[model samples]
Target: MGHQQNALHVKDLNVAVKTPKGMLPLVQNLHLELKPGKILGLAGESGSGKTVTCMALLQLLNPKTMSVKGSIQLHGRELTDLNQKKMRSVLGRDIGFIMQNPMNAFTPVYTIGNQFVETIRSHTVLTKKQAVDLAITSMEKMNLPEPSKLMKKYPFQLSGGMLQRVMIAISMCLRPSVVIADEPTTALDVTNQLQVLRELDRLRTECGTSILLISHDLGVISELADDVAVMRNGRIIETADVFQLFDHPKQEYTKQLLQARPALLLNDQLKRRVI
Candidate 1:
């Protein structure tokens, strides 16, 4: 067992949406652990509460619509009940997120360079020129084709793939100890996805960051995860090492999920052939 130190620990998490009808539980008894320098993938289809769970960890869920009950510890520090200011300190500094929708990553009026500089300066005492240089450098590291030109334009000026790379650069810039990536490659082509995946692997090797990867695609999990959790109806039906979960899934639900995955059509077809 790799048994690296856990950067994030979640226990018995319960989450509910407070609709006019009543408190409707969306997730129940959800638990997970993410170790530093390792990737933990949460695989599930829509309505599985994958996104909700990540929001809860950052304590970013809309207060009026939802409530979360759980013990979340980040680097041994309890994060379940933190004030907004403290939470902000932790968010950009210790934990960063690669949101599913990169289009919403930038303000319409602000140049990407301006926003990137602001984001950097918010977390550190770096000067405007310094932040701008850092932002361009980070974008270059994320493999953007023309970081200088792209930074001069607004969010609307870039393509979806370009925006995704920019978002990745922003999220991983500070080398946050924990990173939560939700469908990060949803908009990218296969080649770009592979590049991003390779960069993500480099992040772990370089920073020892713990990554919580949420994707509907099993292929992403297979590529990046050190551990795998199969989630259904907001619950984890199976948790195991990446290889074990893929090779020998124990739960019926997990098996069904893998079989249903469009990416595994070959395996699903072969299983029927053998049977």
Candidate 2:
């Protein structure tokens, strides 16, 4: 797709942290393109800079210690040079972020409704009641139960799955063009993982929102992504269409990573036993 059609694009992206001794590169020469209404799966092992890439796109890192270079374009607008005030306008309004930890996404002291309303109001001119209605609507779309009742519940009161669903709801409340989901199902059970994935898929279908889905789960990536990029040691080692990557991965690292998944390993053992 061309630049006009791309919802999010990254080119020559690099991120590094300043250490006492020297700068340590965490990500290098990374590139990604997410088309509207499509999901791009970014998968890798832990400490592979998957989260750093996402954070860098929104300039969430500490500027004092972390340095981000290259270009991050959203809807064809360059974000790398935007000031904090302008970047704020782009963050929740143009690009929503769903963090891995559901508990951290919400405040323990505030009710879910309060947080949702605050987020909506900050990004829009809506009154509190209008924002609440938006929250309830988004929550319903996410398949969350008792939208009105959920508003009254605090983050601590809900289960992890419920909180995750709420987080997705909150992130999509503004109907942003792009969403960066960092291991959205990391803490959920298998059933809840499926639920969260389906909800994300539904958002793409319903709102035409592009997604950068960061996860270590190849199974999760295969289930939801149209395109997949494999990261290793702070670099994008391989990228391909989801089917091609799974069926005929070009890189040895990608192959090993796929085989390392618990479900895939179990399947391999089962096939060996059957033979």
Candidate 3:
């Protein structure tokens, strides 16, 4: 597909951090595209620059400490040119972000309802009562128990999995065109992880939302990604359809990654395997 038709397009992207020695490259000459209603998995080991790429895409990286160079276009609009204030409006509305740690996504002092309602109100002309109703409805759709009560509870009162689901609900509630989920299931148990993954898949299918899913877990990627990109040492070495990359990887590094999967995790049938 053409660049203009893509949900997200990144070209010649480079990120570097300033160090006492000099500028140290973290990600170099990266190119990526996410089509609407598709999930693109970014798989790499820790420090492979997956999270850094997400941060740069969202303009969350500190300009003073890190240099980000590239063109990031969402639905043909250049994001790199937007100032912080304009970027804030785009975030949570146009592009949603699910952080690696859900706990850090919200303020501990605020009740879940307070934050959720405020978020809705900020994005739309909804009143407090309307926002509250919307928050409850969204949470219920995520299958969170006692949505109303959950909203009244503090962030500390919820489990990691619940918090993650809450984050997903809030992110999807706005119906953003693109979502960047950074290691969303890392902190959850197997059951919660599966639930989270299922919820993401449902939301994407229902909303036609394009997702850039960043995760070290190949299992998670295999379960959801339509396309996959393998990264090593801050650069993407291979990109292909998910099945092609898993079944017939071209790069030796990609082969090693596939081989490194636990025997139990690998099955004769890809669809039958549980993440």
lDDT of 3 by residue, 1-275 (tens): 75448999999999999999999999999999899899999999899999999999999999999999999999989999999999999999999999999999999999999999999888989888999999999999999999999988999999999999999999988999999999999999777887888888888988999999999988788889999999999999999999999989999988887877655433323345333
After superposing candidate 1 on the true structure, give the runs of residues whose Cα lies further than 4 Å from its correct spot.
1-4, 264-275
| RMSD list, candidates in order | 4.8, 4.2, 2.1
- Comparing candidate 2 with candidate 3, which one achieves the higher lDDT? 3
**Best-performing candidate as measured by TM-score:** 3
List per-prediction Cα lDDT, in the order shown.
0.85, 0.90, 0.91
**Per-structure clash totals for the candidates:** 0, 0, 0
Ranking by TM-score: 3, 2, 1
lDDT of 2 by residue, 1-275 (tens): 54355889899999999999999999999999998889999999999999999899989999999999999999889998899999998989999999999999998999999999999998999988889899999999888889999999999999999999999898898989999999998899877877788788878888899999999988778777999999999999999999999999999999999887757543343334322
Query: For residue 106, what is the lDDT in candidate 2?
Result: 92
TM-score of 1: 0.92
> Cα miss at 2, model 1 (Å)?
10
Give the range of the ten consecutive residues with the poorest summed lDDT in model 2.
266-275
Alpha-carbon runs more than 4 Å astray in model 2: 1-4, 264-275
Each prediction's TM-score against the native?
Answer: 0.92, 0.94, 0.95
